[model samples]
Target chain A: MNMEVAHTREEDKDLLKVAGEIDAYTAPELREALVPLTEKEGNLVVVDLENVDYIDSTGLGIFIGALKSAHNYNGDLKIIGLNERVHRLFSITGLDEVIDIGEEREEAK
Target chain B: MGDAYLRLQEQYRKILNQYLENKNEQGLYHAQQFSKKVLENQISPEEVVSLHLSTLEESFPDIPKGAQDSFEFLLEVMIGYGLAYQEHQSLKDRQRELESEIDVAANMQQTFLPSGIPEPEDLDVGVLSVPASKMSGDYYHFVHDENDCLGVAIADIIGKGVPAALCMSMIKYAMDSLPEQRLQPADLLANLNRVVEQNVASNMFITMMYGSYDVRAHTFQYAGAGHEPGFYYSAEADEFEELSAKGIVLGIKRHAEFREYQRVVAPGDFIVLLSDGVTECRTEQGFIEREEITRLIRNHMHLSAQEMVNHVFHELEKLQGFQLRDDFTLMILRREV
Candidate 1:
């Protein structure tokens, strides 16, 4: 029910490695950890969903909110390491096309 | 209504008079029938108790105080029960009226859907949609324009009931008004998004997949607005690959973009589109995986497109113990040329 976010600073971006289910109840914690990283101008934020097992629509909504916040400051948000289940959520909601679902090196374009 | 109440009172009085006169089996039968009439009219228990006391007074001018005290005790208990019973009856009447309205809306929803499957050349298109409840939260629309184009859309509203039906109506009208060229998958989804975002509430969200089969080109171009990912079966590989596009659910953002996807179909290839009800179908063992659905489709691949679709539904329905938890929709478009 609760998600854990491990923040690791890289060259110019913040990597938020996440674990546990990202559902309605646990999505806010992810939003808090994720949105602030995008608030700073041009900060590239990446969420590693490798450990995530499941995510409901509310979690998808949070990603949308975070994507909006990141874009507002000309910052970029990318998600990588989506397992099959989480990946299916992105594919189902068509978010995979909107958000960058790729590796850390595949940043910006 | 007033006259009916008066007639009911008169009948109750007559039945009581006959019962007090003979206390016979025939009188008892009349009393029982009158009790049923009182219930049918939703007459309160207090009315019956009061009528009984008054009838006793009239029948025996020298009625004893003991009998009178006993009537007062019954009246005291019936007062609370009578009020509750009347309130319950009122609620039942309101519930019945609500159901009637819902039935009308459900019929309207059915009428709005495409009456017959479009018989496009060289394409075997099969569609199946069943609602778990009276009003389906899922909707499918088909548009076969004059330009050798077949457009299909499948949508699922997050919530059900009247609001979902209204949204579906909006989608139906919007699709009807769209020009043929604008019926392309991505364009249609984007246009629908603008319409829904403007008219619908913030909380209301819809997921849709819009696909068009270009008959001459043998291409299926499709797009999604956070709908369930569909599948494409490659004849050469004999494998079912999921088809997906990038987009958010509709009515979320004003300027959300939907990514379009395309697949060129060779002879014997097919595309499968569905709602989450198919992917997330649950049984006593729990949710049957999408892979299981694919297996079922593969097992029934020899049947005609429509039969295959129906076979899968009945199979899923069986696995679900004949109780579908959500609206089930599955569509298949096969290239027969």
Candidate 2:
């Protein structure tokens, strides 16, 4: 299934919301979304993954890329609202420690 | 003598079975000759077994299918053993190559993709690409200057698999060396077409759309090289505008001129660039109407550039049930002006 990307603006921050399967085939959308975040003069960019049903290693790599890009600019790239499956993947891969993954979007802020 | 012949026939069958099972063709041949002699009452089963065992060191030859080894063993076991034989050697050779060919083709297709999108400002460009097979002709990349102006291109070589993939690589490297010529989209296409016509095979051609986004001006100047007409959705009109150029596909004619199409994408306006893969996307009902694609943009025309592109991909997947016969590439440029 093709993944869908949606976002909501809250307090001048772009809360990018993502849903659907993110395999090597569909992961480019995530990368495309994150690349523009760097151009915006925002202090924080929060990615919400609550409805993301599936994610592969390639998808995790995309998150790693966003984290690195955000770090380079001294801005913060944080993840919030991980579903159970995505949370399991992060914990198993130890990405939870490497990234700012939170239980909820509000918690991330 | 007749009884002896019956016993010899049984012994030969056993030897052939062993040779076929164990994949021993030379042994099977030896056993066949010995069985013939036994039927003529010139040798006994014991003599046949002894002859094979003694000569096996020198008699065995290469077994192609491992089918004859058991027949050889059965020949020996019946004289008290047997021998074997193999089938078509060419089939095994082809089977071995099929696996490696797939790997090579996948690597070749991956060569066309950019390792990373170049960093640029003013243009929120996102490329979504998916190859329909192990190898495809779809190619996309972003080139950025120190000034943050980015040149983005998406093209499809007119074929599938290895040959198409090879042509794409050639175009990529040629584009890399033509930075001085990339100032205008038409000049870029002209140079690219000249190079491709000379380098690629006569049967191959490329359909490409190239855009150079002026970050400072918030304008995108692009040229279509016989590719699909891209859509420019004006937030002011709430309708999709066609930005098609009259030009032949690359490699079609040596001096076919390409024309540049320019549009000012204001804040909240979007320019959607795509390969024919999107228009040709077949649904259960039929091929999706170009109008429907534009309507989709109008519906989500308010989202970020990336989000709108992603939603279009999602909608196409839903319409076609996620099966794409051709390469699907889409780039959505939203002006953050």
Candidate 3:
């Protein structure tokens, strides 16, 4: 399914909300919308993947790349509001160890 | 007829007329050029054959009625065959491209055989890896160092192709770089995890089990990174216990910690390690359970290590009606006094 990646400024943090399947086809769109925010000066990026049903490695790669970019710029990036499925992806791939993924899921089911 | 078809037909007619009139190499060259244009323009071969029949018939007006009818029938048949043949050729080209991608993966993949694996006098080893398709996502490598240590690692990339092969290479090189230090499984796994997270392009994650059998100590120290649990068979107790070391799959994080598990191998005891394919073997009935796999191993306990592996593989292959849904890999490290 096609995914929607929306951006909003939450005071000091840049919130990127994504919904639908983030696969190889749609990952570029997410990267396009997400990478710029990470590169901004002192940008605190927070990605909300609560509504995202499936995310392939490419989509996760975009997150890693953005995190590196944020770190290089002396900024920080974190993920929040992940559903159970998305959370498991992070846990299994061990992204949870590096990325600051929050436990407060905005949506369940 | 549409303008495009008319233009193509006229072009085809001109080329054919020139070829018929001269009947020389120059004419044949024009024919070849016309054929290329037809394909480029997405023209069907049937249309070309149809146009050829109509154009040629115009020149042979006084032909016999029966021969004329036969030619008409042949054109009708060729219309279908010619179109189907063109489609088949197009599909064949696509098939070749896919096969070449698989070939690329196959060329890069390396799976150790029994002879290539290290075997200390106290340990009997058997290794078998078979890909269901032309390329296997599962890979296993061994490192035999100066300390009489047998360092073994088995990894399965979630995705296959050139990317999976590259991931395997990264894992292999990381493992190869160890052994010299006789590092613990946890440390080795952590180092490998870093290599995957940093170097891998984030296209795949790998589940791996890394371990070393110390010949002098008679101890097997191992760690896992979200891989299938290995089984330890106690010759004295005649019982099977699962290896408990656990961690996440590699490539998602820059750092991962794997807890190491240690077990002492005594005479006649064996350690069985396998990829998911062996445990998840599906038949018409459905996926066989982990217990079933353990039972298979128990039944073949009397056989030599390599023979046991071969028998189990054949049994699972037969159960699945000689078709494997996934790559199958199984290794046995049996201790013989």
Candidate 1: give the clashing pairs.
Answer: A93-B226, A94-B247
Q: Report i-RMS for every model.
A: 3.6, 19.3, 4.0
What docking class should model 2 receive? incorrect
Model 1 earns a TM-score of: 0.72
- Model 2 lDDT tens row, B73-139: 6555665222111123345658779968888878856766877654455556666887777677788
Which rank order by DockQ, best down to worst? Answer: 1, 3, 2
Q: What share of the true interface contacts does each candidate keep?
A: 0.47, 0.00, 0.14
Candidate ranking under TM-score, highest first, comes to 1, 3, 2
By TM-score, the best candidate is 1
lDDT of 1 at B291: 94
DockQ of each: 0.27, 0.01, 0.14
Docking class of 1: acceptable
State the weakest 10-residue window (summed lDDT) of model 3 chain B.
B106-115
Top candidate (lDDT)? 1
User: Backbone clash tally for model 3?
Assistant: 0
**On a 0 to 1 DockQ scale, where is model 3?**
0.14
* lDDT for A37 (candidate 2): 86
Error of 1 at B258 (Å): 2.5
DockQ of 2: 0.01
lDDT, residue B139, model 2: 85
| TM-score pick, better of 1 and 2 | 1
